[model samples]
Each structure stands twice: as structure tokens, then as C-alpha cells.
Target: MNIAITPFFRTLGEVADVQIGPFGSLLHKADYIAGGIPVINPMHIAPDGIAADPEFSISDEKAASLKRYHLEAGEVIMGRRGEMGRCAVVLPEHAGMICGTGSMKIVPSPEKLIPEYLVHILRSPRARRELENAASGVTMLNLNATALKGLQISLPPLEEQRRIAGILDAADALRRRRREALALLDTLPGAIFAEMFGDPRDNPLGYPARKLSDLCSRITVGVVIKPASYYVDDGVPALRSVNVREGGFDLKDLKYFSQQTNDGPLKKSKMKKGDVVIVRTGQPGRAAVVDEEIAGANCIDMLIASPKEDELLPYFLEAFLNSDAGRQMALSNQTGQVQQHLNATALKGIDFITPPIEEQREFTRRLDEIRRAKENLTTHLGELETLFASLQSRAFAGDL
Candidate 1:
């Protein structure tokens, strides 16, 4: 590596202290209490910031016992395992939180490096590549404090580092605003549905009732295969439970299957436009209408509910499935304790009151307008992501 390429290059260990969270031996489920000191686990660290409330918090006495693991504001916490490089900076309000197992901490010396710059460097593509190389695991990836300390980082003068961090932060803020706008948009359809039909279960309007089996021609499960069979490019699109959302589909993490792998299962569960796809596991009850864009895409562990258009439209079915009543009905029939699941047979039994076809059509027509706006915002978010990636590339390579 060219040492003179930038102002200075140093191993992270040289400029900051890298520490792991408390070991599993120190924490136990029994010690957790309500409204206690928040614990920072892998789930707590997010792109936005440390979650205000984590899944589990410990008693004040227990927290004091684990005082060595207390977090400090301006320090960074990151997942030591799973999606290796995920991290966030702690704010003053979260300074007292205890860093729990499955994460590590990085405390940058203020005189040597800025905390914002440290988070940016860790999130950049260069750091992610290095993190992947350092991680070790057969199933879930793992990162240790030693590996993090050894990460080689390029450091410019404090002023320049702050400048780059500021630019990135501004660009990030724009993306965040666009995301917030999109998130608000995501709720619009559900709001509209609730306004028009009220709750699906209560049916206070006294609309005609119909079982899902009567409205849907078929409610079939998707193909099942090993993760290794999925590809990044040039194959049939394969969606999983991860793809289905309440009001929309997430195509970002889509997988692909080759003809060799697709010959049998793919032929069986082929989807069609207007099919209402419902997740059977990993967040059961979530559903979305399959548009032309992903109509023929093969899915895994999801229910393909092909609605009878004469009685129920794809848009209306999707809205109902995502409503409060529909979610309750779906959840009730769900089996499996750890990973709740919804099979086709159970789903077919769900009773829902159908609105007048003409009314449903009018509601769908109005919904189309909102969806178009959300699509534009989603596209804008994608552009922002691309722009941020490009900026990070140049900033670190000393091209900015």
C-alpha cells in the first residue's frame, strides 16, 4: 500500500480502543427486568442510531454489576456477528446503556479521530470488504475485537476527515428524509383501507361475508430449496417470506434460480399477475399484490392467493390481508412456536367480509395515485443510495 497516497494510514488499533460486549456467561435471561437500563445488543445498533429501547433491559443492580460494559456517548457499537459491519454511534442519552453480547465497541481518541468519521469509515465499502475477510463462521458470520482492531484505515487530517464526514452526513440526511416520506406513504394505503371498510374482523358495516377459499381460486405454497441454489444474476427470480411486506414487496434481496435448479419446483409454483402473495413464515400475515413486474417470479415459503376478480380485486384483497382484522385472523391460525407459520389450508379458512365490487374498484383507482407517488420516492431513494456509494468511493480513495 502507498503510505503517501493520503495524509496518513494507520491500523484502527493505533488510533482507537476496540472492545467486545459482555460475554454470554455474564448475562442471563432471568436477570432481565421491565423499565430497567437498556442493553445494547446487535438489534439495538441501527443505521439511524441506537434504538431507544432494546428487546431486553436489565435491573439497575445488574447493570451496575456489569458496569464495565456500559456504553459512552460518541463511542461506536457494532454487531460482532451477523451482517458483520453493521454499526451505529451512541448519543449522550444512550451513554449509560450496557453493551450486551453479540456486539463490540470502538472508542476513538478525540485527538486522533472524530466519531462521525469513524462510523463513516466503518460503513464504507472498503471497510465492509475488509470486515468480510476478517470474519469467520460456517453458518452465522462472526467478527472479533482483534479483527476490528487490525482493520487498516486511511486517515486524512482532522479537518479533511470532518469535511468528508460532513458531506456524507448531508447526503445521508437527504436520503433519510426521502425514506421518511416513503415510510409515511407506506401507511397511506392501510389508512385508506381502514377508512373505507373499517376492520376486517369487526365488520361493523355489516358487509357480506366470504371465506378466503371462496374468493381465491388457489392458495398455493411456493417452492422450497437450499440457500446455495440461489444466484445473484441470470436466472429465474425467486422470492421468499422476506420479500412480502404489509403493503408492498421488497425485491432488493431477491434470489435467482438456474434452469437446472428451477426445472421441477419453479414449474409448480409459478405466479401470475393479480395474485395476492402472503407470507407463511418470518412475519406471517404480511401480504402484497403481485404486479406485472414480478408476476411470473417464483417464491418460496409464501402463499400465492389468486383472487377471483369478479368478486375480489387484487388490490382489495392485498389491503384486507394487511388490515388489523386480517392480521388477527392470520395470526390466530398460525402454528409453530419459534418460527410461526401459516399454511394454505389454515389460510383458506379465514373469513372476511367483502365490500361491493364497484366500491372496491373505486378504492383501487384512488390507491393507484398514491402508489405512483411512492414508486417515485422509492426510485429517488435508490438514486440516493447510489450517490452515497459513489461519494464514499471517492472520499476514501483521496479522489474527493
Candidate 2:
């Protein structure tokens, strides 16, 4: 049951002190020193934590002059440029870092607001929308102390706030752990491939090698689907480069095909199980094999190759394409000025040392197990993410 308790709304500035970073002129590029105080910029403030070894730093003397911008533990450091409401708390170890021009810091009043609780509210969906709506700029979005302080938040008793924060933190931890497990599982296939065949570039194992195109029946690309042909409920799955993860396909953001669609750009490009799809743009060169589940799916702007089972299996082909040497070959031959590309000819010319089909198949058996485990974790992670979002929604609405 959802319970909506009336919450006392309070402006952020009423309970916390907001301060923007130092003026840009005060910290110029020439003022940076090798060993000195690290500067925290918008890019350095990640959701995880403050980045170590910040690109620019100031001398001891300079840090003293800009000491007013120094961050403290429990204070929230936020990006003043790009992605409106992104903020991360400063850890104890990062206490003395200087806030760069692109950041702002919020110090909550200990008697009125808990820093952890404040951070949770600031990162919530409601708060993000408010922040984005309140932001202003021309080329890039921006946040100012006035805008940050004017945003209002629903306040609960200190104890209740802590309780809500604790529950959310625990849920977030589980989600993060599942994500880490998925990452580890994702790497196992690459590790096994390396152990079996060695690097495609060096060919240290002396396996018979050939041009990538030589081991394939045909190398082709998907057509660019126009806006009119895109649909969701009543068409074929349209896989784009974004849907292609390094070792797997991400089915989350799929746009579907139309009656005129399967007949258009993707006419003969319909995916088949074991067909290797390599990203031709965006995150270029990343490759994954088409699983049976999406065998008949149509794709767009991706390099597709039907591996010759007689010479090279699909598993080896994917592993090699993602291998360091194979990636280098694809990147070197890429075309296009703004959006880089890996055309069929360029992808075909990639060189790789081919291991025997038996050895490749043997490694693939273990590889498949790891992939299955990762997929399971990914599914669980998705559920946890949904739960986390639901919890955040309820907690802020005074239902938790």
C-alpha cells in the first residue's frame, strides 16, 4: 500500500550553505604544478567518487589563496557544467581538494540536515527535474549557487531521513555488487580466448592466420533505417550499433521493423544465429555473435559477417575482433570525419591467427557458460535497478 505523508518543504539554502568554485582567472593552466593540491572539476566528480590524480593541480601557495574553494568531508561536490544535477559527496581522503571552476560545493548544516540524506534527495528524480528546469546557459547547461539553493526539498525528521537513506543505500549496494559480478563474468570469455589462441596481433602461438575476410562467406552492413520505418510493438527487432555490447547484444533499447522495413535496407541483412555483428560506428569495433533468440532480427549500421564454419567458428571471430590487435586494425582503417566508421572492406582486411575449429569450439563451451551466468546477473541487476527506482520514488513521496 502507498502512504502519502505530508512533508514540510524547505528551500535548500535555508538548511545548507552553497558556494560556487573559484573564478576561472584565478586558476589558469600555467598555474598548475606537478605535486600539489588536486583540483576537482565537473568531469572528476563521478557518481562513484572523486577521481584520483586530477589532471590539474596548484602549488601550495596557490592552494592557500584559493583555500575558500577547498572541499570538506560530508560536503556535496557538484558539477556546474553538463548534466544538470550530478553531485558526489567529498570523502574524508579528498577533504582538501580545491573545487575547480566547473564545480560547486554544498555544506549542509549538521544540526538541520544530514549530508548523506541531503545527497540522496539532491540525486533523486524529482530533484533532478527541478534542477534541470532551473538551470540556464547557451551552449552547455549550467547550475549556479542561486539556482541550487532555490530548489526546495521535502524534509522529514532527522531519524526518518537517516532510515530512508540507509534503506536506499543498502539497495544501491546490492545493485552495484550485481553489476560488478556481471563485469567479472563478462571478462571470463576474453581471458579464455587469450589463453587458448594468444593475441591476434602478435600470433605468438604460430596458428595459421589469414585476413578476416578470407574466413567469411560474405561481409556486409545493415541499412540506415529512416524515421518512418521505426516502430516498437508490431515489427522486427532493429539492432543498431548501440544494441551491440562488446560480448553480447543489449536488447533493452530495440526499435522494431515495418512491413516496408524488412523489405528496405535490411532486406537481406536479417540476422542469423552465429552471425558476427561488429559495431561500425559509435563504439566502433566492439563485436558480439547473434544468438538464436534474435536470429531473425533486423539491424542497422552494423558490420555483419557469416563466419565459415569450416575454417573459423563464430566464437573465435568475435573474440578476435575484440582482441587488441583486431581492434587496432579496425580503428586504423576507419573512415569518416565526424562519426568514425569501419566499412566492410576495412573490417574484412583485419588480420588474425586462426586456431583450429576443435580448439575454438572447446573454448567456446566454457565461454558460453560464463555468458549464461553474466546474462542471469544482468537480468537480476535490471530487477534491482527497477526496485531501487521504485524505492526512491516512494521514499521521497513519504511512502517508505
Give the number of the best model, judged by TM-score.
2
lDDT of 1: 0.83
Measured by TM-score, how close is model 1 to the native structure?
0.78
Model 1 lDDT-worst window of ten: 331-340
Q: Rate the local accuracy (lDDT) of all candidates.
A: 0.83, 0.81
Off by over 4 Å in 1: 1-6, 24-34, 52-68, 210-243, 247-270, 279-285, 296-310, 327-352
Q: How far off is residue 291 in model 1, in Å?
A: 2.6
Residue-level lDDT of model 1, residues 145-198, one tens digit each, is: 889999877788788888889999999999999999988988888888888888
Q: State candidate 2's TM-score.
A: 0.83
Per-residue lDDT for 1-400 in model 2, tens only?
9755466878999999999998768888888777689998888876666884644788889999997899999998888888866778888999889988888899988887887777777777877888888888878888889999998877777877898889988988898899889878777777887888777667888988688789898888886546344665777888888888887877887888875767765578888888999898777889999988889887888888999988888887888778766677667743523226778888777676788788988988988788778778888999998898888777666667
Superposed by TM-score, candidate 2 places the C-alpha of residue 74 at a distance from the truth, in angstroms, of 2.8
Compute the lDDT of residue 392 as modeled in candidate 1: 81
The true-versus-predicted C-alpha distance at residue 172 of model 2, in Å, is: 1.9
The C-alpha RMSD in Å for every predicted model, in order, reads 5.4, 4.6
